[model samples]
Target: MVLSSPTWRERFRAGTVIPAHPLALTEQRKLDERHQRALTRYYLAAGAGGVAVGVHTTQFEIRDPRIGLYEPVLALAAEELRASDAIRVAGVCGNTAQAAREAQIARDLKYHAALLNLVALADSSIAEVVAHVRAIGEIMPIIGFYLQPAVGGQYFPVEFWRAFAEIESVIGIKIAPFNRYATQDVLRGVAESGRSHEIALYTGNDDHIVLDLLSGYHFSGCDLQIRGGLLGHWSVWTSCAVELHRQVRQAVESGKLVDPKWLLRNAEVTDMNAALFDVGHHFHGCIAGINEVLRRQGLLAGRWCLNPAEDLSGGQAQELDRVIATYPHLVDDQFVKQNLDTWLS
Candidate 1:
């Protein structure tokens, strides 16, 4: 009996951070329906009920089956995220029968969640990846891609997360493992699964997300899912990954502050995005650095369909614009040069 949402736990017990209002808009950004319901009430008052602004089927679908318009790229990724009120349009199941038919395209296209990437079934078993996440959680809310803990790269056995934390629509577990003692035994079977906040253990491990959030040991009370798993040196390491995830979640909720002057001003773009996790599909070099910054801000058209990610030529786009010119507040060379002709027309 552990499942609650009392208006997102009364805005996280009133500490607040809700954000999720962008529901795919158009009619010429001429937003009006009461300004899209006051931009989803300022995206649920900025952070939207706990938080979830997704997009990580490794660069939103390109595993190649001759990329036929999957319903116009899922309605242009849900109309470029409903022209941004905050963002929410995720449905990249891609396998295990398109993650059970994208859970009926996330409940008939009212998507707010469904991001399972069993990294192409990391060579099966963990009861066939918990029977393909109990057939995509019977239809939505599943987030289990323990990233890569098995399949020629094994070691994630806490009895395979005690059969993946007893399933009940497996709320979370995004490890990005290869080491860390099988993600510290899948965080001790998610705190002996009495169902910690129903479940959540997120951490795509970007170069040890601020020393694994200052070693509160494996996700001490988890909740951290950074988007576009930063592949190669994303414009000089996405402004040192937005101030090292805002100084490690503000030193885990205001323990004063600890600054490395923005991690030594983008320490060589976080050592070239921690040097592509030492070769060979280190999260597909953060999905080829978020598809070469969405194909240099044309919102992508091409960049070699997720093989060994190729395309950013001319000396790797001038060394990714010299580590994205040492973070001008996370990329603003004139908003990628005036939205590069309205996103590469």
Candidate 2:
């Protein structure tokens, strides 16, 4: 569906009532265009909040770079994400085995896009990455990543980024490393260039989105691909939390809902997600938590994934239950319910 965030002009176009259905995705190209437009508006709109969807690569493996494809399990995850309006879904792959599969998964599943990293590809050279991008571009949208080694040993040079961004199919960039200067430099370059509007600089700096946005320093930097507002546990928490924030922020800005009132309602749910970050082995725990939350609300069968098994343990699930009990508002139950109705009908 063509899901444009309801802006003031959009609201005026919408008039008194907002249609339940946004737009039809009769053709795949239209769907792609809609996703691109949505990404642009969400990042550039004043106070707009955008989210990058997360996926695990344990289930999928990209054995060869020439032909982009993944295992069946990865395909399943991508399929589920494609059906959701929560946010843009990208393969959050690990090591070399699965890294090659990300671009393939993005294409095979018809996913809106994916976040590419060294671990995801296992080949860090700009030349290799450029070739990978060229091949993947024929498949789906690719969001380039530059992460610090300590933050997961994912790093790509500024020159590499400049080269990658030069590609038309490359839609966005996620700056994951904590180095503020480098992020600023890259953003400054993007802004100075004529293509600022077409590309996005996503703040991978989880703790600093608000600071960067409010700062007088303006560059092509826009949007956030984070775990809500919580950054402690990144892998699993980033996209989900960011999704909640985007939905809450959009509702308030659209005048379809009031702030602080429903705003508190959204946070109440996000708090449960935030609490997951504090749990041990938070990366795995957080992904486990997402499925736990989903299963509790009957969204999924259970939390399941392949090796380095990031799935939550039984005890963590118990803790998640406790958190949910204390804060029932954390589930986005109403939104879930509405979608369920549509799906079942």
Q: Across residues 1-345, which tens digit of lDDT does each residue of candidate 2 receive?
A: 898776432222121111001111112212222322332222222122323333222222223333222433334343434433333335545544344455565556555566665565655576876777766666666666666554354555556666777777776666556577777656654554445555655545433533332233454454321212212222222233445455643553464434455545434544554455323454445544654554454334444432235557557767776775786543445544444433323
- Clashing residue pairs in candidate 2 (N, C-alpha, C atoms within 3 angstroms): 53-88, 99-120, 149-153, 226-238, 227-238, 228-241, 228-242, 269-330
What are the Cα lDDT values of the candidates? 0.46, 0.45
lDDT of 2 at 23: 13
The C-alpha stretches of model 1 lying farther than 4 A from their native spots are 1-24, 27-99, 103-114, 117-132, 137-161, 165-172, 175-186, 190-328, 331-335, 342-344
Candidate 2 regions with alpha-carbon error over 4 angstroms: 1-54, 57-114, 120-123, 138-140, 147-153, 177-186, 192-194, 203-274, 277-282, 313-315, 318-330, 337-345
Candidate 2, residue 56: Cα displacement in angstroms equals: 2.6
Among these predicted structures, which one has the highest lDDT?
1
**Candidates' TM-scores?**
0.29, 0.54
Model 1 lDDT per residue over 98-211, tens place: 667656754565554465656666567778878887887777666555555422234557877757777887765555564677767777776666564565555555445445
Assess candidate 1 and give its TM-score to the true structure: 0.29
C-alpha lDDT of residue 287 in model 1? 42
